[model samples]
Target: MKKLAAGNWKMNGLAAHLSEAEALAGAHAQPGCEVLICPPATLIARMAQTLGDAPIALGGQDCHSADSGAHTGDVSAVMLKDAGASYVILGHSERRTDHKETDAAVRVKTEAAWRSNLTAIVCIGETLAEREDGKTLDVVGTQMKGALPDGCTAENVVVAYEPVWAIGTGKVPTMEQIAEVHDFMRTELTARFGDAAAGIRLLYGGSVKPDNADEIFAVSNVDGALVGGASLKADDFGGIIGALERA
Candidate 1:
């Protein structure tokens, strides 16, 4: 499977931010690994246009399970695809906490994304307290099993493990800890998905920065990163991308 360097901008970025997106695309027109940026829904179309022929890809932060409905504030997978996004993120920790999203909801949304031909990047992880309680693997295992849909393939699904506490807290797991969780996720996927699991990309997302990116990518089964704050700027994200290329 191709390594992936994905950025989840979350609720940040405005029209002014498209310049940074443009610079990132222009600077690395030929990145070694697959490059993706999930900007705010407002910027998807413009960023897609700005990215033009660059190797970089565009994605959405979230989508509703319904194809089209009167959900008011919700955006559907069909809408995201029409806005030029080839991918959509689901079950992110923030969405899980802030909006009270459940694993079942994520699974439904993931299936919705696939229905629109959009790859689903489903996130799974444990809370700080859960980690402290020594339930990291248990929490993640349950989330992964519940959030992922049936008939998933590497081509349409990617799993991201983002420890909730580490997301923007600037605290990262030790290298060995990261390796343990990733290896466990790989094992679980292999057990459930069979050989197809080998082709699925697994990403680590937290306080992933340029300085830590290379070492993280070097960890066993750490295919790449789902960067947060650092991904907002071209220079910072480009540095991480450079490290992934080197890794």
Candidate 2:
């Protein structure tokens, strides 16, 4: 399976930031691994233009579960697809916290993404409190059971494990910790989805900077990374992409 290097621009990125994405596309026109950039919805169409003919793919930070409705201020999955987004991040920690999204909600949104022919990158992780309570696997497992829809395949679904405590805090878990979670996720997915699960890419997110990307990618079952802050700049994201290409 091809490894993935996904950059979540999060709530950041303006028209001015398109230059960075353009540079990233120019630098890695033929990366060894699949490269993706999820910029703010406002920039997806423009960035798609900037990256025209480049191997890099464009995505959206989030989307509403419904294809269309009077959901004010909400962009639906179909709308994102129409905007030139091939993927959409769902149930991100920030969205789960800020908007109080639940696993059921994420599951429906994932289905919505699929309905639009958009791949869904489902985000799941334990909070600092849950981690301290020693329920990391249990928390993520429950989230997975509820967040992921049936019929998920490698072509339409990806999973990202982002420890809430580590994101943007520059705090990385020991490699052992990351490996444990990833291994557990793989096991759980295999049990539920059988052979199809093996192809589903598992990504480790949270403070995934270029400096530590190689080591993270080396861990077992770590197919790639879902980068945060490091993804904002072309040089930083390219460095991580280089690490993945080497992985």
The best candidate in terms of lDDT: 2
lDDT of 1: 0.93
lDDT tens digits, residues 1-247, model 1?
A: 7799999998899999999998998899889999999999999999988888889889999999999978999899999999999999999999999999999999999999999999999999999899999999999999999999987889999999999999899999999999999999999999999988998999999999999998999999999889989999999999999999999
At residue 111, what lDDT does model 1 achieve?
A: 96
Candidate 1 regions with alpha-carbon error over 4 angstroms: none
Q: Write the per-residue lDDT of candidate 2 for residues 57-107, one digit (tens) a residue.
A: 888989998999999999999889898999999999999999999999999
Off by over 4 Å in 2: none
For all predicted structures, in order, the TM-scores are: 0.99, 0.99
Each prediction's whole-model lDDT (CA): 0.93, 0.94
Candidate 1 global TM-score: 0.99
Model 2: lDDT equals 0.94
Alpha-carbon shift of residue 89 in model 2 (angstroms) = 0.2
